[model samples]
Target: MSAVNDTSFNSAVFLLTGIPGKEDVHLWISIPFFLIYVISIVGNSVIILIIKTDPSLHVPMYIFLSMLAVTDIGLSMSTMPSTLGIFLFNYKEISLDACFAQLFFVHLFSFSESSVLLLMSFDRFIAICNPLRYASILTLPRIAKMGLVCALRSVALVFPLPFLLKRFPYCHTNVLSHSYCLYQEVMKQACSDITVNSIYGFAVKLLAVGLDSLLIFLSYVMILTTVLSVTSSTESIKALNTCVSHVCAILFYYLPDIGLSVIHRFGNSSSNLPQVVMGYIYLLIPPLMNPVVYSMKNKHLRSRLFKAFCK
Candidate 1:
């Protein structure tokens, strides 16, 4: 029973490709994906450049912006390169090991990006509501430490995924739907009973998506309370405006994350097609949207980026 299951699980027959009919659409789909990739890179790179050059924007908010940009770029780069390559070529095959490796890093950075957004929200809260103590609370050393902590936290949480998957006997299918290797997607292809994999994946989500969202929600609650208490309308508006980009970023960052977690936990494996599409949308959309959100909402970032590029 187990051997037959393993063979079936490891076989390429399990791989889902473009629906048997709409093969032609693959070429066209890449157009928008390629465009978004370009925008994400260029926009994030611009944010980094502007931050480095414009000392006036060197406060904690921009520092968090820089961190968020870095994480966004890192997350997009992990999945985009391989995905884009597939659009241009015929042999879109990946080894099991390579697939899991990409999955681990992509997930690790995705979680880290979430943590960074949470940190950024907190930074805005301090800057807007607790203006007097913003500098004291969000000093350079503290930002650096936060970055290190989140990076370490994400890596530690996700690194075990690859090792755990390697233990599952390769039953059959190696072809991953969409671009990168995903846990639930690949677990269905496992030779062994996937109960263990499912359990561990749930645990990963608890640490990654579960707690991350809680912290983010709490941070915003504090921010909203602080913003509302202001006596001066101008001060209140300014404080609220300061959080605009952060709120947009958080929405972009969390909506898909929460959506994916629910799909993995509740949606049937047969319905993975929707989840796969949703995964790419979430993965690709946020990075591209971050710059749009920040550029449109943040006058300071806009002005600094303009001045830096102009010079």
Candidate 2:
């Protein structure tokens, strides 16, 4: 890999776009964007608040749900500043330091969310497949440790990204597809050889998001196996019902990412609108829908939220 000591490369500025080729309609688009920001912030906030205040929700499932809510809040907030600037105020310039900082937090929360989802799936597996040992297996201390590990794992893995990029020179075009910075998106503009960055980035993705997804799927398979072995249909339905919200949460988190990947892989690169929409869905939909999904599926949370709002 080549390194450049040019001051201009180090001080390069990146330009972020809202929706390429759709700038004319951005004014109207800002309406939904603004609403999404508001809903995600308020919705996840309510979930966190509810989980904290309700003594009955002091269980492993609820604790994981609270962790998911916190991650959603961080993920949403990471993109909102630049996204709102692009859509509402037409602010497109982002310094290298600021861009890298945003990139760090964005990936940090994304990986953390993936980690929490995996843990939540494991929680379901234990609660369903090993009911008697559920409480014994996942005590409060263990749960806290799991949460800490998730946070630390994400931070440690993504911490090297910005510094890695900084070592390279960005002398090429600085335009990015989305308003926020991403690892692959930023590294593509570097003049130096990015072989190391690409390899390391893929390794991290494979180990964190890809590996976590595989394990979560295996957890559900085990859960299904246990559910089927139960004798009574009523009991089987009850066992599966508890997993609906979590399954929905998983779908919400991964489907858009898959779609965006497909779009980028096959769709015409000249057409940026599709990529932009899919990217927004990846970031916005989960945070907005997660609370709604959990509250509706969980009767206790639903009732508490109802009473909380009514008062």
Candidate 3:
């Protein structure tokens, strides 16, 4: 593949990279990736279906969960085609527009997922700390409005990314680091001055995901404090029990994400294999595991899922 120098953004193409040194076994590798995509799709879809069809789950917590399922599905869809294409078909060439579009949706859903998790944290906080007001505070219309705000925030922040990258000329190798596009990976490929792109990208991640994480942390802190203040041990246990699934969700999503970011920023350049593995773990595991976590933790959801499967 030739280097892209002084090329128009519309005409430029990027070669997506599969696992380093594992190109010969890409077909074999695709089996697990394909299964991941299928399970993520089916799992999140089932979660959404159960939430939507079950009148009993029409509360704030489950509403946020349904939103999360949708975001997971969106994230899976955003990465699936290019990822599976590279591994299964050796179709690694991606057009500039398509790459940018994929990056946008991937980050969009990712940020929105963080936001939904924060919202869920708040849901738990209110439900546990101030149970009497929970119904008044998190009504359906209010939840809908909150979801809209999260969607708009994600779009508003992510929409400018493609345009910002497009303004820069890529005179270096256009081969990307991952099978699917990422903002940082794509920005590194540009030959021109990327100071603005780098600053803006960092700022966006800090503002969106970083802030959401901080708030989620604070929400949990308050939750724990509230639980401790309860006079009855049974009440405390019940309150904490309600948060088990959400806590699992948070850990599954953020731990891998934080590890991936650390690997990207500080990892050795010679270790492409670890970086690629972390990327897959960061992107695929949360979506694949969230439904399972929720199903196992929530008795109602577990029963519904079992009935659905048995049927």
Quote each prediction's TM-score: 0.90, 0.96, 0.96
**Each model's C-alpha lDDT?**
0.78, 0.91, 0.90
lDDT of 2 by residue, 4-52 (tens): 4487887799999898878888889899988998998899999889889
lDDT score of residue 298 within candidate 3: 91
Q: For this target, which candidate reaches the highest lDDT against the unseen true structure?
A: 2
**Collision pairs in model 2:** none
Clashes in predicted model 1: 8
Misplaced by over 4 Å in model 2 are 1-5, 262-267
RMSD to the true structure for each prediction, in A, is: 2.9, 2.1, 2.3
Model 1: lDDT equals 0.78
All candidates in order of lDDT, best leading = 2, 3, 1
lDDT score for residue 119 of model 1: 87
